[model samples]
Target: MFLLWFLACGLVDAEGEPRIEAHRCAAGYYPENSATGCAKALEAGFGTLEFDLVLTRDDVAVIHHDPFVNPEICTLADGTRLGEEEADRVYFKDITAAEARAGYLCGGIEVEDFPTQALVDEPIMTWAELLDMIEGHPDVYLHIDIKWEGDLSRPPDTYARVVMEEFWARELPNDYYVSAEYPEPLQEVEKLDSSVVTSWSWPSFPDGESTTLVAIGHELQTTLGTEDLVQLANDAKVDELNIPWQVADRRRVEDAVASGLPIQLWTLNTAAGLEAFGKWPVEALITDYPAGDAP
Candidate 1:
């Protein structure tokens, strides 16, 4: 109870609504411009934050989706990318994680999603920094999708769990949800903190670990199929089912609901689809649109 109250104190601010984070602070707009887009998300009363985590050349954690500099947002101010076409020259692999941070201005450094996004020039921060951001806003919950480098040298989930232990050891509030496609990584996360909700990501890997949304026909088996995963999540005390938005019609969504699993569609933008999919109960969703960032 004391912990809860302490956190609640951080939630109250001059503004009545909590600053629920929606999209990553797109690489563009920030406080100087109109705060309408992202700020409105906060104002709309969503208290959970979602963003991608990338490793800098230094191996420091940064908030980015791609392992390489995105051509879509690459600019010359940070580094020489000849043209947007030259983004391939800047593949994150070419540089160490450290160099990646030094090389590019991140987050609001490029084309911004909202006028509210502040242009950040510093290197991407460590996962620790991401946690600190969440901790500061006591009332805010987080839905962080794990970003793997695809090196296959080490499991991405394992690296994340170690950092997560730091958060847990600090007695950080259990207000965030983590999802990953790697089996070993996701399982490792379960060992690290079972109470912290976990989600099975798709495109099932070698061990078939990340296949959260498997075919319905394959669900009724002892094997590690989609059905098994749904049960595993439930047995492991996971909270919801997260699937790609294009997982097909409402009938599938309705079946998932019938099983008592709430659907959380990934990386959606338009509101029209959301309204249409509203027929089924959606526990959460990941969207690029900060305009309607509220859950």
Candidate 2:
């Protein structure tokens, strides 16, 4: 159906041009949040790549999905495998980024969880390491999901500044975008340098309410109505809105489009889901499989 609509709407040609963002640096192929994952996505013809950033004890940001090391996937530097119960206690906040990097082999473990992931010994990479991989490929777009877990190791502004400073130093023409569930860090980012593109990640609850907008590190704000969502985004100085595809219905898409704010849908995996969402007016679709259904 999307293929038919694609021709009718002229959305894309044989090249399939609806923007596809490789979520977690193509988590389907490599270890999630690794430099190799970033490289693989760029080589696979994905122009946009997304990864999660969590701060280490020394205020250095690194690429990792969960705030802690997972026992199922990672083995410590001395080959210590933490039990499920002990994993969460080993927080990245307790260790320096260098210590964190030296402490793990991120791939080839958890075979039952990600059987298809390629076997490689990858260090937990720094934000700088990942960014370095993208420098020569200016055509690529980087989307950062800045994770804030209420850790006071670094001030909120300091956290945002470190990340934004990397982008500012690049001076490349708008090749990056940052997103957070709340506005605190991004607000600080804007304060430091308004030139960087930032998006507020608005959440949708299961109770059928699509109006929950969180400004973490500040306050919890609710939208008066569905129609007001777009205007609220603009008023907040948000460049775009990132919503999970499961909760983004027709009205949400229409409302976003009406307000002139682009929507990037998250974690849509299957080809059918991709095709269905492609029919919408979304700016980007984020997924783990950029080169889908591959060996």
Candidate 3:
């Protein structure tokens, strides 16, 4: 009861609307990271759309989540499909943006986990196409998660430069953010355009641990100390801190707020989670169903 009151009467600013960022443009109802999904989110009155970005073989930026295509969310554009054995072998970095689009149809494969998701034949959107969609809606914000897998064989600076250059060429009208777990890409973004917002995202664990253990591990690590964590974000020239919801407890949120940086909690999907956190004063809620009413 107290927690609910605190969220309703304390956390939110009197003058500010609770900022809601649609995860993958409301992936609960539409295909994750699809153009049509984003359109639905915008039409539903969400002010922000959070999506993913991966560079194609030719260094063009395209909107997709996994470093490689997942057969569960996508399938081959050609008459022949990618066999299960070929799924992990094909890399987005090896295909041109057009080839990437011509190669697969997004939202076609039904995600068993997200049965509510409307399956539609939407093509994987290029960063350029996404920018074009949001061109007139200056109020709509974008959160671009740079999906980089550590292939130390390639320089981070080179990849960062490519991503940043793509943003520059488009000159998006709305305020957009670029973030990664590491500082290299953000550093490059800062160097290229300080005006554009940059963020640093960290998981509860190293990122591939079991889901059940992540919350416990995150609490143990971040709770032990926060000064170093706060300092690291500052050193990275990050404009904001993006932490998983599980670790953004009162103490951690307070610590981050004290550092003078606004924080965003990521990937919350339930109404219970939303209503619970809605009372806590944070920058925004990153959710799959942003339109759902929460207490």
Candidate 4:
């Protein structure tokens, strides 16, 4: 308990800003997403929730990281032949929005298997559903990641318009944020809403990177000094930058702090890594696993 507070207190960015954020509490893991994920994350007292949003063939919102149903968490109704992996057999492409709602088994054979998880028999969540959830939880910060490019094979402005319009309609927490791996799609979001009120994914770093180690490669190429990143984004006139902590350098981290743009590091789940990012200029963080101790 003391350690969490001390670590939290030690975080200071350039100009002495503080950076800290909860990972994917909104997207429950081990048990997959459920009410449990949402409930527990709320209990952990996170300032923001990072969640991935995907679409079904029926055009419904499904909160998942991947396009397929991982067999580790899914099974046939009973007669369908099992495959090497669940993902191989079950895909969002095959499942309609209706089918997703019937029931789902994620990561384990049964919900009871993972007691800590939210085991739900409902279909995957849709965008409207997620938005409604967010509306209800006004206090939580939303770090929404758009998982669809809109056209699947290509891109669609609808992806941004739909989500962004709804966000504005609900007048969700001003602290809430949005990001996307597809910069093109994100550009749409930026164009639609240019206010400085929202938060973004991560910072865009420059230089060159090596593929030697994924992490090392990121450090070499994607990571930059925080200040430089701010200039890059501002010069480009973009709204947000989703950066990986592994790739961010002190200059990049510090610049983000001074600029007042929300900073969120990626995939951090370790105590050491969390502590390290906390010490930087980051304003928020995205981790795969919630430390649960929630700062």
Candidate 5:
């Protein structure tokens, strides 16, 4: 099925359209990181799918954006909704995957940000499960963002090894790249296998105020200059640059492009955003609304 799609419409064609990566598996239309959401994104014609990966206490990698299950999008197995305080205490690193699957059901709640997302009850998926689901879509590309909390998570080497093991075990024909904001995990991946492609994401703020254009622009100007960030990617031997849309100004985009590596701008869901950033020669645009047309 995917082979025919790939042959019919490759990511880039004669028209030179930028490839679309389904961010969090089309989070705007379906539950973020859920299997249903991922399948829908593929069915919707998104060749590349992006999602997050975190490890359980048993060293099993799971498809979850945060280290802890988000209360806003999940409910307890017994049908009780989780509150912020209670959910914060339940870390993936402290529980086994079976315990997580048996203890909680994710999705069904309406996410305030994703107004159009459908409500569906589903279990948290494991890395193996995700691989199995995409088996039929052999040509689909994967953009895996590894998640971990500082000090509270396992060692970077261990985490990287586990993720790599899962990939090796499957040995599927899909083209994929793994990424992390910090360089340690990617560095560990390089050590394990230099052949694997990796990307480095930058400009993450410690104060959690990194979302807006102003804050990200300020950080780029002051502490995390684009030149320096590109040099950091070089030092880490990363194959691509995964940059936030807000900070991907003309200068930063040029700097990343100057590095001769592919640049992927993320989470641009609006037509205005697509129009603004589309002028740049980015390799791909990661978005929650892959089916949205830019006017």
Candidate 6:
């Protein structure tokens, strides 16, 4: 079933148009990672939805972009605002899924960068809840970005097992893939279930334009020839490469195509970006404004 769906995804690239994956559930139109945003994206005809995942204290997966609740966009359950320092102390790993849903509300304030985002108060969503919402939309593909930044308690292998267990239990019909900046989590996922598809997300550059990272280690990868980067991804056993648009030059994209591995670009929201990157023969373009007229 997934094989057929993946082939259909490739057909989009064959038509010279990269499939658009809604980043954070069309965050430019709705609140980032909110259930409302996800529903809106599906309503707006998005075939692919990308979201972040983090485990709660009880090892339940929840949809959230950050490890900690951000005071800038979230408020307490009683509608009380939280200070940045206070919000920082509330880590997802430290709270149970029930506590996360009942103790806080996100999307109360607009993200400064997304000027047109709708301001709607919403609770955090469990992985089960998200799956239920999208059950009717089986054609929709999911790009799950795992967030495990060096937490000793939740090692990469443990994280992969927990997430894969939840996924296997659901027996979802929709096609999906897992992605992470570091390859350990993806490698572990492959070890757990070789049938599952995994994407290797490249760390962002130091300009801070991207959310993932901007370390010296990534600088080396970006500086390397496209073949070398593709070889590295092959070594990691990732099925695809999720790259930042800033460094996805024409030559590099062409080289990746020659290597026969699909490349997906991220966070492209502008008309110019869509116009420019759309010319590349990549597999998908992830954007915050999938419902907008930009693409």
Best by TM-score: 5
Model 5, which residues run further than 4 Å from truth? 1-15, 207-227, 293-295
Q: RMSD of model 1, in Å? A: 11.4
Q: Better model by TM-score, 4 or 5?
A: 5
All models, RMSD in angstroms: 11.4, 6.0, 3.9, 6.7, 8.0, 7.6
Task: Supply candidate 3's per-residue lDDT for 214.
Answer: 67
After TM-score superposition, the amount by which residue 219's alpha carbon in candidate 5 deviates from its true location, in angstroms, is 3.4
lDDT of 1 by residue, 1-295 (tens): 9998888874321212222236553212232111232343344445666656655444455555565566544444445443444334465435665565556654344454444444544444456655654554566666666656467323465456554665676666647777665444555667776776766655333332444445333444423334443564565455555666665335545556567765566655566654454434556555555455323
Off by over 4 Å in 2: 1-17, 86-88, 111-113, 204-228, 231-236
- lDDT digits (tens) for residues 1-295 of candidate 6: 9998888774333347898999999888889889998888887779899988888888888888777777888899998887777434578888889999999999978687888788899899888888778877878999989877655225788779888788778787889999987788899999998988888887523222453444434555656643365776878888888888765656666777778888899879898888778878888899987765653
Error of 6 at 149 (Å): 1.2
Candidate 4 local Cα displacement, residue 139, angstroms: 1.7
How do all models score by TM-score? 0.64, 0.81, 0.84, 0.70, 0.87, 0.86
Q: lDDT per residue, candidate 3, 257-279, as tens digits?
A: 77777778887878888767766
Superior by TM-score: candidate 2 or candidate 6: 6
Model 4 misplaced stretches (Cα beyond 4 Å)? 1-20, 26-32, 77-95, 107-122, 149-154, 196-218, 221-237, 259-262, 288-295
**Which wins on lDDT, candidate 3 or candidate 5?**
5
Backbone steric clashes in candidate 4, count: 24
Clashes of each: 15, 0, 2, 24, 0, 0
Better of 2 and 6 by lDDT: 6
In terms of lDDT, model 5 sits at 0.80
lDDT measured at residue 15 in model 5 versus the true structure, 0 to 100: 29
* Predicted structure 2: lDDT: 0.73
Q: Which scores higher on TM-score, 4 or 6?
A: 6
Query: For candidate 5, lDDT tens digit of each residue in 171-221?
Result: 888998888877788888989999888888775544235357645565656
Preferred candidate (lDDT higher): 4 or 6: 6
